[model samples]
Every structure is written in structure tokens, then in C-alpha cells.
Target: DQQVKQNSPSLSVQEGRISILNCDYTNSMFDYFLWYKKYPAEGPTFLISISSIKDKNEDGRFTVFLNKSAKHLSLHIVPSQPGDSAVYFCAAPFLTGNQFYFGTGTSLTVIP
Candidate 1:
């Protein structure tokens, strides 16, 4: 079974709106969570992250929220723009620290 999962395969939002992406993990040992954005043929760029100890972390237009008790986390983008269209992935390193687990990813499209 997959350790991390993105329940939504894709999401579309109008420009200047909010885009919400959700992810779930089965591991309680995941101490840190990160969100990454990827464009076609390009590598994923780190967006934002929240530690298990933190309930929320925000960076400019992006924010990541973690609910450790529920083993869930979410990414929120404000004023979504066409340029923001990309695949977003949630990831965390395993307890061993040598390996990491990533969600399948959720494709986000911001319509102009």
C-alpha cells in the first residue's frame, strides 16, 4: 500500500481564486512535510512545508497545514494564477531518514 496518497487526481480553479490540495499519509513517524510544484519536463520546485509539530506554515501566497493527529495535510494557494498550473506533490521522509515517500500528486489548473 502507498504510504502517501493524493485523493484528488486533478483540480481546476479560476484565476484569483483559491486552490486547495489535499494529501494523506499513513506514517506517524513523518516529522516533516513538504509541498512541491512541477511543470512538464521540469523538476519539482519546493513550495512550502510544515513540521509535524506545527499546525500551519505560510509563505507568501502558499500555505501548508498539517494535522498530525489525523495524519493529513493540505496545501493552499491564494489568488491562483495561470502560471501556477502544475502538478503538486506532497512528500515526507521516512523514519529511517534514508528514504522518502511522495504522494502521486494532484494536477492543478488555474483558468484565466
Candidate 2:
């Protein structure tokens, strides 16, 4: 079974709107959560992260929310732009091991 999963395979939003992506994990010991955005033929770049101690973290138009009890998290992008279109992935570092768990990723398209 996958430790981290992205429930939505794709999402579409109009420009200047909000784009929300959801993620879930089965592991309870994950302490660090990260979101990455990737363009075609390139490696993913880190966007935002939230520690387990905090429920929310934000950077400009990107925000991440963590719900430890539910083992769930979500990424929110406000005023979504056409340039924001990409594959967004959520990842969690394992507490007991060096390996990391990553979600399948959600493809987001911001329509002009």
C-alpha cells in the first residue's frame, strides 16, 4: 500500500481563483510534510512545508495545512495563474527511516 496518496489526479481552475489539492497518509509518525511543483522534463522544486507541530504554513500565494489526527493534508493556491499549471506533489519524511513517502501528484491547470 502507498503511504502517501493524492486523491485527485487532476484539477482545473480559472485564473485568479483558488486551487486546492488534497493528500493523505497512512503513517502516523510522519513529522515533516512538503509540497513540490514540477514542470515537464524537469525535477520537482520545493514549494512549501509544514512541520507536525504546526497546523498551517503559508508562503505568498501557497499554503499548506496539516491535520495530524486525520493523517490528512491539503495545499491551497490563491489567485491561481496560468503559470501555476503543473504537477504538484506532496511528500513526507519517515520518522523511523531515511526513506521518504510521496504522493502520486495532482496535475493542476489554470485556465486563462
Candidate 3:
């Protein structure tokens, strides 16, 4: 079974604080990992990604770490902002072209 699990369905943090989102997967074939941020009524936008060959990737205030041996991954946001309040989805590339497997989602709320 292909299950990308985001056990915690939501998280809340105050502005200018750090926010961490977690994800786990059982499939080992997934080599490309990605994090997407979604706003209400809008499609998810790619945040960051790391190849299975790499353990960590970072972009500005967003960072993603992949632990292939443990089959786990996480997204970290430094100094979370009110504008960062939205749903985050973790995904991995599927064997099929242009296909992806996604976690249910985690809603992050940043208090102003």
C-alpha cells in the first residue's frame, strides 16, 4: 500500500515563530520528495523539494529534510508569518509520469 501519512492534521503558531510539519511514508520507491503550500480556493504551490539521494534541501525561510532510512520527512519554516497560514501537503513523485502521491494535508495557522 502506498500511504503517505501526515499524522497531525493541523498546527498553529504565532507569527515570527518556527513551524514544523511532519510526514511519513511506507514506500521506498519514492525518490523525489516535495512540499506544497495551498491557500484557500487555490491550487498547491511547490515550496521545496529534495531528491532521495540528498538528505536536506532549503529555500529561504522554508526547508525540507528527508530521512530515507527512516522513511520520514519534515518541513520547517522559520519565523512563520501570517501569510503562511494555509494547508501544506507533502508529496512524492509517482512511477507514472507527472503523477504524485500526497498526504491528506496539514493546516497551519499563524496568529497575527
- The Cα RMSD of model 2 versus the native structure comes to 1.0
Q: What pairs collide in candidate 3?
A: none
lDDT of each: 0.93, 0.95, 0.93
Q: How many residue pairs clash in each candidate?
A: 0, 0, 0
Q: What lDDT tens digits, residue by residue, belong to model 2 across residues 1-112?
A: 8999998999999999999999999989889999999999999999999999999999999999999999999999999999999999999988665888899999999999
State the displacement of the C-alpha of residue 66, model 2, in Å, after optimal TM-score superposition.
0.7
User: What does candidate 1's lDDT look like per residue over 1-112, in tens digits?
Assistant: 8999999999999999999999999978889988999999999999898888789999999989888889999999998999999999999988677898999999999999
Which stretches in model 1 have alpha-carbon errors above 4 Å?
A: none
Give the CA lDDT, 0 to 100, for residue 107 in model 2.
99
TM-scores of all candidate predictions against the true structure: 0.97, 0.96, 0.94
Question: Best to worst by lDDT, what's the order?
Answer: 2, 1, 3
* Candidate 2 clash pair list: none
